[model samples]
Target chain A: MTGRMIQRIAPDALAQLSAGRSTVLVSGTNGKSTTTAMIVAALGGAVATNTTGANMPGGVIEAYSRSRARVAVMEVDELYVPAIGASTLPEIFVALNLSRDQMDRMHEVGSVARRWSGYLDGSEVHVIANATDPNIVAAVGTRSATWVDPGWAWRQDSVVCPRCTEVLMWESARWSCVCGLRQPVADYTVEGDVVHTLHGGSLRLELSLPGAVNLGNAAFAIAVAQRRGVDSDLAARRISAIDDVEGRYGTIQVGGRTARTLLAKNPAGWASLLPMLADDDVLIVSINADEVDGLDTSWLWDVPFEELAGRTVGAHGVHRSDVALRLEVAGALPVVDADIHRLAGRLPQGPCVIAATYGSFETLRGRR
Target chain B: MTNRLTIAHVFPALLGTYGDAGNVSVLRYRAEVRGIRVSIVDVLPGDPVPATADLYVIGGGEDAQEMRATELLRADSGLSMAVHRGAPVLAVCAGMQILGEWFTDGSDSRVAGLGLLDLRTDRRSVRAVGDVIADTTGVLDLPTLIGFENHRGATSLGADARPLARVLHGIGNGAAEPVEGALQGSVIGTYLHGPVLALNPALADYLLTQVVGDLAPMDDVRAEEFRANRFQRARA
Candidate 1:
């Protein structure tokens, strides 16, 4: 739906909102935006979302201001934590790992955990949480939760072990806890790098979006939808038909070239998109401190740029100068940063992609 | 004229905000700009705490992270010896809480800390997010560090380690000054949201001197220019 349609039709349309028409609330430190968009498509038509992607109260207010659908599948940031909980906390809540995110704005993972725990405490709600996380599964799960669904994605990414607060063992299959309590979680499995629910059948979390994390998100979306009483067969069917999540693994066609569009906020999100690009594809990036974008941009590291190999990349943003320079320092090949217009045009000459964090997506959405 | 030193760190994975990395990063960056190396050690706990590392940093995580970090640190006699030998460590948020004799878990369970420092941590109520600044001997121009407090626990000062700053924003030692942070040896812990090193450069420089001493060389003319330019732009 266009931004204009959302503003004008979203509110009045809610009166017609139905229960089977599921609205999934994707909450966590990372991967919420891309996952929400992908899962929305997985749920098929009759769904609307807020792409302003603020994750705060004002941002959601800005989103709901425009969206119209049977289900209001929305994203929530930690700053808007209390408000979202107080207002539009959907019937189904899919909480990704409560790891540390923007420390400048959101507190560490515990901050989110503590907040979510109390909010969810004693509520007879369906919670799709990552079971492998010691915090979510062990500590929180030990509490009285309605239903527990484990995550299969992000089993291999470099993350903190819940116990040691150190990097968990990045095993070939999945990560291991350093504290001896780390179990070899085999049932919590991933195929084609996607997390699969026990009942969601064996179709790789093939939600047109690329990345194991997306697959985990797909699983969570499917799980949440199921909890909201969507039929298992229909939810499964709808998820399989999914084919996009917008700028987050969305695409653009400029002239004869195809540029895969990705929005990377932190090094983790950056790593998720890097693997999908061919070594020879051209790349564009944007970063900034706009609004609640969490002004601390030091997280650009931790993204193993070496994994990108020798691909040539170009970038732009309000912090274009900083983004450009950091890429240079990290040994990335630089391209021209002549405004988003120039970069958009030059980007599609080769197999290319555009990545940005902050409202930089406006340039992409407006261009389309 | 001596060059100001500053160290900028990308820390979220390290300390997991249990909210201490802010103080660590803020203090280091603020100090280094005045001229200190401020070696940024992305030390994953239990991996080898680098020998004689000038400053140690950690953040909070799920009770699991705290349990694991404390256990891992306890297992390492060598690292604890290093900290005991007078290494200037700056921990914030969760970092400071884990330094003392013990930390209570989510179940109101208690676990032993490194004992290299003295302090105690206990899980508290849920709603702790608000402006926090502590009144203390160490004066900073910035008002109470503006950040949210989303932790479910609270720390109590022990006999040895002292409360670094009075509770400024939220509850510190049940309403004391320079509250959410701690100070023992060179260690300073607080719930200051990374303390945001780029904005508070003075504290950053102070942290750098702890590790690299006062004479370390840095060649980032652009970073200096960038900091000055950003600060200037904000003012203008």
Candidate 2:
């Protein structure tokens, strides 16, 4: 309702309102909301952001209209980054890893990377990019930017070089293509719990968010904060206080069982989050095919569900049958139940880990 | 001893855009359930196409990646020889476009395809993306083929090609003619990428039978239920 009304009332309002403010646009397949929230918290002092997960243009306008802050940090959708970049003239643009996401609605990963490359070429915005992802390296490698190697786990989208189409050569910590494209030397690198800078200084990050991916997100957020002259230690302290971002990685009680809801939207996200689960964890995988969920469940095959081969699993949501079939093929018998509360009741004792898509996660999070 | 069936997944890294790799998983799962031994060989770019495989599968990709995949596939005569030797091939979306005579690239320039099928593809102004229901009754002997269609290519078939199905719901080829995909000899190509084989088990079985001869049918209640649910959702 708010988005439509804002769209109708002032179609050009975003361009007008963002004319004088210095903006930072955060975009990627995953971690946009969390990273943007971390940046907002780290910057402190009247920083405006789209906390409602409305990263689109209208939502951005509504967010800006609601705040009187001069500095704005906004999460822009990957596909809409070019348009938003044009209108916002952002001071800093953070490029996270690119991967296949919502195949039903999104363009292939290569096309999106190429679009980002076109926008970044000859532009004055300072780009903070992931050096580990070959797609990101190919996108913004030529331009001078602050590259960070937070490490990438999902190689399916980066197996073939985006520039030369040759198979990339993968080594222990870096990857390179025979055509001379390679992961850039990082201006900032994450080593264990500490982030090392090239200038012989480092910040030990203590992130409250779970998973190595969140640490990587914090590393990027710290880099952005450092560029803005915010104290690195102060930024790390601020980021560590954020335990949850927009209901992600939050514990909720349902049907007398405690569960931590983790949002795994794509193959890359699943690759990062699945390893955090223990062998005996009660796993509930939920899926939905609504407009936000992309209406296609074929990506389930790409995920390494075989890791849960010996575990007891529960499948819930509109696409429970699809999830059940995937799990069954992966050598696990899954109980298919559409009711979340009922599924929660059947979970084994101890804390459960619930991995869900966008719609399923939102529905369960709303119940809290 | 059970006879082992070898399936070649072509350029999975380049051509797997829309969970299209799920098609290979469905084939393997269905085959394993029926007590048939299966071996999957992933053929990456620059790798030699294993011509001895019983079946070949390729999925969708981005335009640039598709063009590169077509170039690599055309350079290797092994796939063409395998197709000539009667190995069944399943190609989806961008893969389907690359198996044709030619397709439009990013600059609207025509790039040559493998020419295994008598078809050509050109980009349309508007992309056709939504739920698709096709009537494959006579062709594949399936009830109602259900899947999701997302493509911008307007493919036209020649005399040597016949459509695998007729579009009953969404746009198929995005052309004035209402055909879905082209089928030539043992080669099948379509834009339906619910990883089409997962939703249409009969089609997977048909491709399997083409290699292993007539086989007894196993219970496909789960596949049937999945199809029914998707069909109902498409209607809704």
Candidate 3:
């Protein structure tokens, strides 16, 4: 019910949305929240967004109420994308990448892919999309949406081909065919793993998240910043300065102690991030199935956890026992385990790494 | 003594983004666990395409990239040779799109492919975004709920090739009904991004086996460890 009301109210901003109101809508699965947040963070104005990560219909309405910023930065739900309606066509549209996210809530990616099918058909608004995603690749040139980050890179395991079970190929994770698809891949990057995109001359960014996906997110943000008339170099510099979104691979310090914290909500996200964990550090890992983190944890069977190393380690969360059992099955190096609340004081005196899924962080954040 | 595996990644050039580098980290982690070392050789647009590699990987890209990379591969005259020699090649998303006979962008402009896979691709979509699930099929496991279903075109497999998976979500061949996955030779294709190693160890095992098969003991032990770490961290 609330979802319908918000859709009705979204057009309320149309009066304020000047033909002059150039805006950005960065959408996708994992990176949508962080990438949208990064755009909102660096590009100051009455930037509106759903930073709480409520990408559904109500969240979009909530984002609008939270800020009257001339430039709106918001994350769009993959399933609810159609709910955005016509009033919210952003002046600048950005997509980090198209991947399967929550299953219980939405149809297959192709459901939304069908909606954006016109994306290949063409776009009047300045558009930004990851060059690597096939759905987006298929759309380019037709709608004339500009492709960004055309380079040689590849995702592991990969998005399967619908016809054959084979994985797609890559040159660099970046590639763009002139099939009439045109967009410049972001080149100027800020230090510290942040990307500064200069699309239409505006600038925006301040993300420290790891993963080539985040880098693409930052790059897309830079492109939006440029589209909004932000300075390119400045935007690039701003992006490289930070390190994370709250739990989507963020780092945190707890108990007046130095510990980097991060969140991995699913198998794909975890797969991309797990390789980066420091082997030498004492680590505390957590998991939870709160709706925000996707209620099912069975995908846990899909992750590659043996990489934790031979150091001291512990686990906790709503599914703590299950996690422990998996660890035990792996014959992991044994150590004393504690729940999130009991972790800080019990942690070894060293640079500690606290990692968790969605609900686990609330408990850890209080300890922080 | 450490066993180091040299990896060669063939990235199709001129696509939209290069976020696919995540695969290297996944490969490196698996190798590191068994006390193995990984050295990477990132082969990009301008670089020389190698004829043989221990493991071959390709990522997603835009339509423009498909044509550019495909043209470059055709010009190289050696990539097909490498795949023919059974170089366990892996392609994801748009990379897979380009490997087939042709892919027409949304504009209906068709670009030719290297034709390694007996399939044809076109830029058109019946769906997009969110939980694209597919059950494995054919030479591969016929049913696996892998993530990622964001593509505008539909892929149609040829007589000789088998599908990578059956579509549990998202459209597979531009047809309204969900089909299976894309495949050719040792290569498997999909749009389900994220370092696949993190979630589906089976996929990781397949890739590792093709490369360091006997050298790596990636039974349930590796899968267990990977899951334990992520699950542990997810716990608050």
Candidate 4:
């Protein structure tokens, strides 16, 4: 496989290849691929990036090797951020919100935050972090960084203060701990489709990506681009051009039916994506418990699947029964079908929303 | 008349790291299938722990949140009184670690547990993470239990405690004793975090039987399929 070859040939290739490039490292539990694409689009000048979600160090090396660009924007996996950051010495490091993702393979949220804190401590690298996420604030510490409050949606992983281990108080759109640690004041604030920056004043960002999470990603990407000397309005306009970031929010024609593919890997992702579903939307949830997908489907219980109670639900993929069971328990009647293509054909003739995990999403994307 | 059963999910916002909240859902669903009226009370941090619930369920969480949950649970005299009154409890992973007498963090600092179970957990250099298949011969009336285990703490049971299962496949308890979890009185603790009960229906029925005595068995095709899939994946 190409990955194995890349691992063997150039284990430390990422460092050497990205030496002279103005690298922007984007790392997060979700929206890494989309954010990376948005940043690359905003830069618009000979930027090389891992647009297909191969986000490990080797992937970064491969992306750099395949391109003749002087500027590199790569999506780094959250666990690999420290190692890659140390190697690439990125000009801009973006720390997005931290939440529970792939628990079987990934470190706990607190552990990840601690690792980030250790990596960022006293480092001179300019960092962009989320101000609303307590974990990100704790990780960034006193590091000189541009903090932005795009709005915090998933609070389960950030309820406990990372510094004091005390339950944080959430009020007035901000989180404050009893131990005196609180959400930092943002240099850039995202309020209702507008990004308000400290220096450039306010710029209205009309992003093509749906959901408040995507808007947050756009705000961070535009801030990073602006800091790198890109015009703020131009950056926003370029980011808005990205309607689909590698199959996300894109339409796939399968079995004579066109389905909109949306990816929800973990409970937090599902919490954000499920609300975007329309009331009459025909929903197809595909789950796979492969090695890449964490092999644990218990998080299905944590998702508010009851939101799909009135919708016609169809479960597809390797863990179709598991998805059906969770939906059934949540008061929805889900029809289980292992064959996704066949399931697509059997669905009523209408626009259907396909929510899938990482592996399943890739399979659907490949089909497209 | 449907027998009423109340299940308290303790600190789900804090102690729900590995989808362990599914364990509570499994218990509620299994109970409802047996013609029992189920009511779930989510006891969050700063909320008063209900003194009387038929069952109490706690899930896994991060080390910091686990320590915080232990502190809050220890302060709740109502939970202690409920355990004293023979209420059944199911705790998983970090929840199991905190239900014990004490848990030591990675930095060798120790925090006192709820003292509901006579067990102690110490951090280990190697975090045991993978698929786990345990022999629940004596603990539950099931031949084999399937789940996933991801933890760093090596738990040891005292004289008054017994292991809920033997580690048949993965490294559980992180001890040379070949044990998985501890069982004391009506409390069950385990590191298996496939929402263990969801993959093993008999285990859910066993916990329900502790409260309502004998229970009718329902068709468990989905549970059996889940167990088979997990076993296959574990072997692969």
* Top lDDT prediction, candidate number: 2
lDDT comparison, 2 vs 4, better candidate = 2
Task: For model 3, report DockQ.
Answer: 0.05
Given candidate 1, what's the lDDT at residue A180?
58
Steric clash pairs (candidate 4): none
lDDT (0-100) at residue A95 of candidate 2? 88
Q: Per-residue lDDT of A210-306 in model 4, one digit per residue for the tens?
A: 8888888888988898898888889989999899988788998777788899999898899888878776678999998787888778788888887
Docking class of 4: medium
Global lDDT scores for all candidate models = 0.55, 0.86, 0.58, 0.84
lDDT of 2 at A351: 67
Q: For each candidate, what's the DockQ?
A: 0.16, 0.60, 0.05, 0.69
The worst-scoring run of ten residues by lDDT in candidate 3 chain A lies at A157-166
* Per-residue lDDT over B49-97 for candidate 3, one digit per residue giving the tens place of the 0 to 100 score: 7876667777665444555567767677556777888877777767777
Q: What local lDDT does model 4 show for residue A6?
A: 66
On lDDT, who's better, 3 or 4?
4
* Ranking of models by lDDT: 2, 4, 3, 1
RMSD of 1: 7.8
Candidate 2 at B47: error in angstroms? 1.0
Local accuracy of candidate 1 as per-residue lDDT tens digits, A17-123: 32334455677767777667656655666666766465654455555545556576778875444446545546667666654455456645555665676677745
Error of 2 at B57 (Å): 1.1
Number of backbone-clashing residue pairs for each candidate, in the order shown: 65, 0, 150, 0
Better of 2 and 4 by DockQ: 4
Cα lDDT tens digits for candidate 2, A102-183: 8777857888888988988857899998998888888886778899888545788887889988778888868998899998
